[model samples]
Target chain A: MAHRWKNDLTRADATPYAAFMNRRQLMGGALGLGLIGAAGAARAAEELVPNSWEDITQYNNYYEFGTRKDDPARNAHTLTTSPWTVKIDGLVDNPGDYSMAQILDAMTIEERIYRFRCVEAWSMVIPWNGFELADLLTMAGVQDGAKYVAFETALRPDEMPGVSYPVLDWPYVEGLRLDEAMHPLTMMATGIYGKTIPNQNGAPMRLVVPWKYGFKSIKSIVRITLTEDEPPTSWNKANAREYGFYSNVNPEVDHPRWSQASERLVGGGLFARRQPTLMFNGYADEVASLYEGMDLSKFI
Target chain B: MSIADRINPLARKLPTWVVYVLYLLPVPVLLYMAQTGGLGREPVKALEHELGEIAIQLLIIGLCISPLRRFAGVNLLKFRRAFGILAFVYVVLHLLVWAVLDVQTLERVWADIVKRPYITVGMGAFVLMLPLIATSNNRAVRWLGPLWRQVHLLTYPVVLLAAVHFIWVRKGFQIEPILYLAVIGGLLALRLIPKRARVAA
Candidate 1:
């Protein structure tokens, strides 16, 4: 069945590639535009300015590499993403280790510009190139009684410095309900801005659930399991009080240590004011129905 | 000559204001880096963390003064006041950056301070420093006499709260913040040793 969902954001919405390469040029360009066309530039500024590829690739929360934001960028190069094999099992008809080449051959990839909101109250607009998660699940053949889908990240202690520290339970995990997993908005991202994703930004492949907080999008995926029981998540296991399993982006449901009502936009320079966080990270219109009967505050 | 005897004469010759100047040198450099993209993708956050870390470092250095004098025979006692004042200045800059550039709205700032435990703890540390900052001058020190030492004892709780704030602000049980807390706990524990025991040593 073809997905009915259409992308509200276009390529023009993305931060320019040239600008990503040199931010000084972008600033100078913005200043030049402001001088020439004040009203037009003001309107342009009002529109979403997706984070540069540098911002997305450099600042990451991939704890497998390390805890610090820049640690992944520095250390993740050692991870061997090539010849990767993902183990797909549990309640699926065709359960086996599918090679990355096979998966890419089987799926039809597309671009999705999404607003990524982190649980830490920071956000970025990312343009991802991937296939819908449903397509991959359908290919694997999800069996009956599979209520939930669990995902795991590759754990390599030698390659990943952060794993040795016990920053998070090794092999970080995340799960989503079967219905939510089948949603068209749920994606298996392979690249960013038409380039193969850098190791720091979850190389080879990663899950992208725009409606949920960024952590829910498990990176460097090694395993996918379709199960009846709700699987544990890394952040939730570390501190259940602060990080809920659902971990949906909800302004009303603040993290115990910090408020989620507003978020700082990355690559907006030092003086950029924090913008009010949107419910479902501005994808509520498409995904709000998925949680229709359930209470978000309780789940979060 | 003893190491202290050799170093103390030069230390005394160096004006105390040089300590203030040296400590404050990073403020402008950090601000400039933040403006020019040298602070990385999230300059605001990097700036905030850098400022807060510096403030905590200053507080830790302030805690080191008595220990350095007693255990190491280093007489940095005269520069202790500059460490406190500079730490307070960094804390103020950190708070201002969050309130003005980061939070932007007054209502949200107040709500965050009230609702968030980490922010509440951080703000509590900031509030406790007020009385200490007010009485840091020589006139107030002389006027309060022995009572001044009792009031300045607030440094223990302030440093503890600051460290706790750092730990609580982290997403997970990170070693960096925990190390800060451990160092602070150790420094404060050093005060428990009797002066007679120290003299005996």
Candidate 2:
């Protein structure tokens, strides 16, 4: 069957055009400074590059590992990704633990380049390699009563230091409406840029819901429960006023502390001009129908 | 001689202009780091945070001046004005980075200051510092005399507002901002102690 969601974006389109121009200007300034080595200057001139894996891996908010952005990179190495098991239960015919090998063998994997927008008003273009989340749920044989799909992250207190502190309720959890979870765009990613996902970026497998805020794309997923009720999400539970359960990438809905009207492109360096945030993060055409006849502002 | 008596002679030898130079050093260093991508992926946010942190640190240090003299016998009164002015400068830079670099629109900036309680508190702190910064000079100090101390008393509210601003800006319950608030609160509390008891101790 032809996929309804066709990816018009190539790897070249990952970084926005303005960011490329900004990098070029920055390269010129760097050369004038004579601080950058010839090798550094050459690397800087490369256009159409997505944020390097370094940026994606190093700058993270994997609170299971720690709260600070760099903490995950430094601390996530302790996480055991190999021989992982995902518990699939709650309104499913096959309600049991599925091993990584079983899950991978039963699914088809593909690369999906997506715009990742954080609620903190920063964004990155991530090229994720994985399979549609629906495939996994189908494998679990989701029952008729399932209205929501809940996900839970692996909670190993011995491995994750951030759990020691009451940052948020441990074993970070997230959820999506069953329809949204089954959407073709919703992916269960196991790799990034053609490599095994780094521990810092949620090793083994993670959910990637591009249209929603990044937190909705929970990391290091260990459980999938199809339920009849809307499951509570970590951020929403932490502060419902700021983080709504829906959390669609809506520019109009301003986060109480900061403006969501615009976002700073992560790889665009320090001086890059802020770009206006897109409605549904530029995927309105595909996902807008899911929320028809509903007020997004209220849902958000 | 007491340790503070010995420290006082060394402290006296330390020039007031050195405070300005030392405190102002972070501005260029941070800009250079931002330019070179040393501040990680989100440099604008990092720069804003660093500047705000420095401003708060300076404000805390400025607050220590009186208590240090009254209790510790370590006089740093000469550098107090320098610390206050430098902190104001960083506060201005922090606002500029958010307004000019991060937000980048006048309407949005105004809207944020009005709508966001944290930004409003931050702006209130900035506004409260204006008079303190303006009068942080010898001529104004001479002209205003006793009234000058009363006017500068605004620092208490300014520091409280700044601490609240920091606490509110963070996404989750972070310990660092809370620690800053606690330290500031303790420093402010010290000012309430009886002067005779403080001197006697």
Candidate 3:
């Protein structure tokens, strides 16, 4: 009755949820079916890095899901994830379309415990479920001219009420330097907390930029363009002072209007003392290499 | 006391029943949450925030009562006292949650206020609510006598403090808090204009 996956399960923290589903399947006599039937938590958890998916996605700065803390969770239930596809184009050799099913089939997902830092000054430890971007880029065959990789999420105003805001440029945009994109720590996340991606948290596909602020991670992606240019991202374009393209997690590069030194966990209650934000979000060992010899102060 | 013994029957009974009923609203909300097994995983904090926001919204409505009577012609009068008390209730609950669960000590609480500007503003706003709460009852109102008018003026300061609390509470000036401030500010300003000046001489 035990799940094939366990805590030794990897970054996406598929252990607990998968264990639950395996037990459920064993009891239902559908154990050998080998496919999920409402074992959603398992799929999301296993597929994503553990805790990588917000215990509540509403806390995410993706106002594209709606502004309130609980709005994204409440409203994101309407998305249809099965029909999803991500188009890989531009400087890539495999400049074509790929379905969600195909993308999953092509790569093995790993769980990475990433300390998520928001520009607003909050932090979370999330085990994300996704493979190295280098592996995916390797499949796509990045061209020599490719300096950055751009990501785009689907823009449907009907379901995503936040997209109606003039505050942002419709579809969410994010980019990574070629080296950052190719780093082992960078991932194309599809699920979290051992389940398929939640509709609100950018299901099917999203990117996890560990050392950067949460917004830099980008969610609900539809297109990935390997380009020679440094892409103008949505947040940076909206407020240059608040959101920089590098968006590194550094206490020194304080958010223009607020201090970056400490953060409070939303839903962590008013009483939870704001904790000092760790430099590089505690991922300095893994990700600090990407920015070697570069001054984070100037870049940030 | 019998209805015949009441000095001002309508004044005495209507406000009393209204206050009692008003005080009862938050109970159902709290109960349903309790029945739902305490607002889920991070129940205390989430519930505290929800209750606090609802309370603030109610205060805004209460502040709107006179404007409602003048402009909308709604008999929202009976609800004003209730609104004020409920807003105070939520504010108190908001503080209690922080003081007990979050801070755990007065020293730590004071330190938090000093260390963080938002916390300082938030606690200061809560302190402002104390006098307004004490003066809400007829006994204290009668005891203070003419000073009652001046003491109740704390409402004006409380409103400003609440706005300031919310402004600094946000990482950046958020739209919702700003909207609340503008609306609330406009209403309070409307109260200061001389009423007779508007009428023809």
Best-fitting candidate, scored by TM-score? 1
| lDDT on C-alpha atoms for all candidate structures | 0.88, 0.88, 0.70
True contacts kept of 2: 0.67
For each candidate, give its TM-score against the true structure: 0.92, 0.92, 0.72
Q: For residues A132-207, could you state the per-residue lDDT of candidate 1 as single tens digits?
A: 9999999999999899999999988888888888788788999999999999999999999999988998889999
Which stretches of model 3 miss by more than 4 angstroms? Answer: A1-62, A89-102, A111-127, A193-195, A227-229, A250-278, A292-300, B1-12, B15-21, B24-41, B68-82, B102-121, B134-151, B164-179
| TM-score, chain B, predicted structure 3 | 0.76
- Candidate 2 vs candidate 3: which has greater TM-score? 2
What digit string (tens of lDDT, one per residue) describes model 3 on residues A186-275? 887876766676777778788888788888888888899999999989888877766789999887666655567656554454245455
- Say which docking band candidate 3 falls in: incorrect
Q: Could you tell which candidate, 1 or 2, scores higher by TM-score?
A: 1
Predicted complex 2: DockQ: 0.59
lDDT of 1 at B153: 96
Interface RMSD of every predicted model, in angstroms: 1.0, 1.2, 5.8
| Model 3, residue A276: C-alpha shift (Å) | 6.4
